[model samples]
Target chain A: MAVEKFLVEASHIMMFARSVGDANQIYYDADYAKTTEPGTIIAPPTFAQSSAQFDPDYFLRPKIGEPWFGSGKEPTGIKRESSGGGGGGGGGLHAEQHFEYHRHLHPGDVLSATVKPGKTWEKESKRAGKLVFSESITEYRDQHGELVITARGVGVRTERPVDSK
Target chain B: MALKASNLRVGDTHSVCIVEDLKRTQIVQYAGSSGDYNPLHTDEIFTVKVAGYPSVFAHGMLTMGMTGRMLTDYVGDGRLTKYGVRFTNQVWPGDTLQATTTVEEVADGIVKLKVETTNQNGVSVLSGYAEARVD
Candidate 1:
């Protein structure tokens, strides 16, 4: 399976920067940012993960019959037909997320992020039935092609009876 | 005043910093900028009816940004080597958020801080920890 990639522009970054009330010249004032911060104009710390305009239907929404939803939603009956559901039906749950910043991101630094599965393991939940835990890693790179940030997010999919109480 | 790593001990606390009367405009700005249109954060009707929240709330990242600003204000830029947080609760408009930081660990040019934000009633809104590299 191939992981999808997305591109984000400076406008998106600036929008999030403004939303956070970040007055740092680096985010808005390009000249000021260049002069103030060592990099082009350092992006606010949380900016990278913030203003993402991903199409949930394609990028985030899980494939039909995948036996799980993306973050918090329950599994629907739709099936991919292409990718086979491994076993009993269940759903996915968001577990945790971690991010590592290499250096400050700046305006005009086109960013490309790729999200892919990092790891998966099986576990049993007393309440939710059999669960498959997985981690997705999204790596971001700047226009200069440097690794700016790396984010790893964990999710759990359960294979429990839907009507089980 | 610079915060010295050696001066900070486990259980050491900082003065309460209050951000008075957060407004809806700030929340809107955060939503517009962050692309997080999770109505629980912006649309009042949606938040109330769908999410069952009392009112529109601020984005978790916005609250974290405020905390980051506080750390930067105290320690200066480029000094925050490692910062991380977990969103524990939500914050609504007109609420005054009081922030506090407690030194949890210090070693090798790094100081671990347990940061928390609370509402007027002293109920915690956000609680997490961060580590900063101090000179």
Candidate 2:
């Protein structure tokens, strides 16, 4: 598969700041950020993860090949048994998130992000049954070709009937 | 200039910082500004019907920002060496986030700390660790 590259614009930064209810003068007010410790209104560390502007269908859309799969949802890529059989339901659960910041990303700082598959494997679960674990890492770079941020996240997925009760 | 490994112990914990209760409007404004239209975070009905959430919730990044505030307070300017975190759970409006830090290991002027944020119910909303260097 070809790697998809995306550009994160300044407006996105403002929007992320708004979504998080971050009223910090640094993020919204340029003057404040310039005077602040980071020396610029820098993006909140987790802001990049919340952008949600990626092509969700490609990597995140659930049950790509399953007929009974629902819309707006994607399989967590986690399966129960080593033979790929089921144990308990619920496709996947959030496992962990890790972020590293090199420099403060400010307004008007265009960021280019390239996401790639990091790892995939299976694990035995005591309660939720067997699980599939997938991880992806997205690296963001500024227009100046400087590293801005790096994020690695894991999603635990399983094959189970949708919960109705 | 170097933070010795003995500087931080496993049991060393910092004072807790209590964030003021954020309003629904603040969350909504964030939705409009950030472009993260995940209904689970901005729309009450969508949250209940689709995501099974109680109500509109704050963005995870918002909670992370609060953690950043804690760092700024501790290290001051030009002193922060390295910072990182992992998002563990969701944070809803009206939820108060309390952040606490504990020294884990300090070696060669670098301080490693475990950081966490929890809600009033004592449920951990975000759990992760961080490392910083002091000048």
* Candidate topping lDDT: 1
Q: Give per-residue CA lDDT, model 2, range A1-165, as digits (tens).
A: 122344555556666655554455666676766786668666665666644455343332233465422213542223323434232122344466677767656667666677789899987655445668888887887778787777787766645312221
Worst 10 residues of 1 chain B by lDDT: B45-54
TM accuracy, model 1: 0.66
What tens-digit string does per-residue lDDT give for candidate 1 at A26-104?
A: 5566666555425465666666665255534433233456533212332222332323222222223344445566865
**Candidate 1 residue runs with Cα over 4 Å from true position:** A1-15, A24-40, A54-97, A117-136, A152-165, B1-18
Candidate 1 lDDT by residue in tens digits, B59-123: 66788776666665555444555566654555779878878888888889888888888887787
Q: What is the lDDT of candidate 1?
A: 0.60
Residue B85 error, candidate 1, Å? 2.0
Q: TM-score, chain B only, every model?
A: 0.86, 0.79
Query: Against the hidden reference, what TM-scores do the models get?
Result: 0.66, 0.67
